[model samples]
Target: MKNKFTLILVLFLYINLVNCDYYQSKTIVPHDLPNKVTHLHFYYFDIHTGNNPSAVIVARPNQTNEKNPKKSSLYGTVFAIDNPLREGPEETSNVVGNAQGLYVSSSQSEDVTLTMYVDYAFTSGELNGSSFSVLSRNPVREPTRELAVVGGRGKFRMATSFALIRAHFLNVTTGDGIIEYNVTIFHY
Candidate 1:
């Protein structure tokens, strides 16, 4: 009887271990190469003028904080955006996509700096419904900046690239800007 019980227990352990599908996992590199590379250029409109604005300040620094910068630098201000993307720098130009996200002024320097989180959602092309994400720090006073293309979907799936952004036109009084973007993307 003792020998039979031992044999039954050993058989149960063997069966459980032999068919353990969830016991381990394996890592693999993609068999397909990342051979598709594309370049794109567009204009991003940050319209803050008129009755209908595309971007608006949602939060501001405490007025009593002496260390906080004023509106000149916009430090500690957060803006929510649903701006337009155009084929040309002009606001009336053809609309191709939209940029929807939020940005915060995080720099204490005299020059305005923003930590931006935005997504470029394409609307009117073969790439319609596809979107790519940009999360980066932008120094607005600088002539040029490079933003990271963190991730993407649809035609831009598994994308890894950067965007060169520059202020094409800026209205200091109203805080409006038409920025240009040159993007390079690589995907499988």
Candidate 2:
């Protein structure tokens, strides 16, 4: 009876150990690659009138242009450096990554909402070519916004984190602006 009880207890302990996600007493070693730091420039044009060529107006039922023309959506790519009015991407500049997403706002409304997905690629670093993705949401009109780090690849594989976004320049007249993003990621 004693031996049978001991065997059952040992089997239970083994199963629990195998099913556990992490071991408490195990040593956690740091990753071989260093943390990547990047400051990216997010530029938007004609944000107020939504007149930029990239901007598109989505239509909804029972919505008119004068009232609620659905919402104006704009999407474009961003760079690692701060280039407000530049026409295209600068190759000489450090190409960290790109942001391809859109923002929408009501007619004649100052409050706008945005959903941007930012992907980061290290150009020259210990973890070069390794990339991570951030899903950003702007729920209201504010000077600063926060983004969630959803996932990643390569050295940043399975990473999760967040970011802080601040508007560096916003031209109410031309409806152009430059936003800065500071991201923090946690990975294996």
Candidate 3:
């Protein structure tokens, strides 16, 4: 009788062990990858002047003159932008989003570069309420600039990618310009 009881106990323990292993195998998590990629195209208006401008010069460096003023850098200068992102180059075009942030002239040399930190927040279309953050250096004179997409929110969550900003139009005297942007984002 004692040997039969011992055999039953061992059988029960074996069954519990098998069940535990089965449950554990079922609980294994699936791997998440940044496999999805998407492209977004928009136009950004750099409005530095007018009564109601989109971008404004918030700070500037002390007066300094270089032999070639045009070759001089805008170091220590800062600008704040809440620029409208539109479907077309015209400001009258339908507003899709807004690029809001601050960019500072970080280059201490002759290059007119800005250390940019901006968030593109959408207000219309499929990506409404979604936004992505950009943190990179922008050489304004470059015909095509690539900026890194650090992260994002909403549909863009866990995203990483780049943005191609090309010169669309420029007004030298007014410091107003229109830029074409093509952003590619990857996410889980």
lDDT string, candidate 1, 1-188, tens digits? 99999999999999999989885876557555556888999999998878999999999876654664442557789999999999999768999999999999999777888999999999998989988999999988889899999988988888889999999999988889999999998776
Query: What do the candidate models score in CA lDDT, each in turn?
Result: 0.89, 0.54, 0.89
Among the numbered candidates, top TM-score falls to 1
Query: TM-score for all predictions?
Result: 0.82, 0.49, 0.77
Per-residue alpha-carbon lDDT of candidate 2 for residues 83-111, written as tens digits (9 for 90 to 100): 22222233244444434344333323445
Which 10-residue window in model 2 sums to the lowest lDDT? 79-88
Question: What would the per-residue lDDT of candidate 3 be over residues 1-188, giving only the tens digit for each residue?
Answer: 99999999999999888878555655533244437888999999989888999988898987676676665446888999999999999878999999999999888776578899999999998899999999999998889999999999989987899999987998866779999999999876
- The true-versus-predicted C-alpha distance at residue 160 of model 1, in Å, is 1.0
Q: Which residue ranges in model 1 land beyond 4 Å of their true spot?
A: 1-28, 65-73
Residue 7 C-alpha lDDT in model 3: 100
* Candidate 1 pairs with clashing backbones: none
Model 1 TM-score on a 0 to 1 scale: 0.82
List the candidate numbers ranked by TM-score, top first: 1, 3, 2
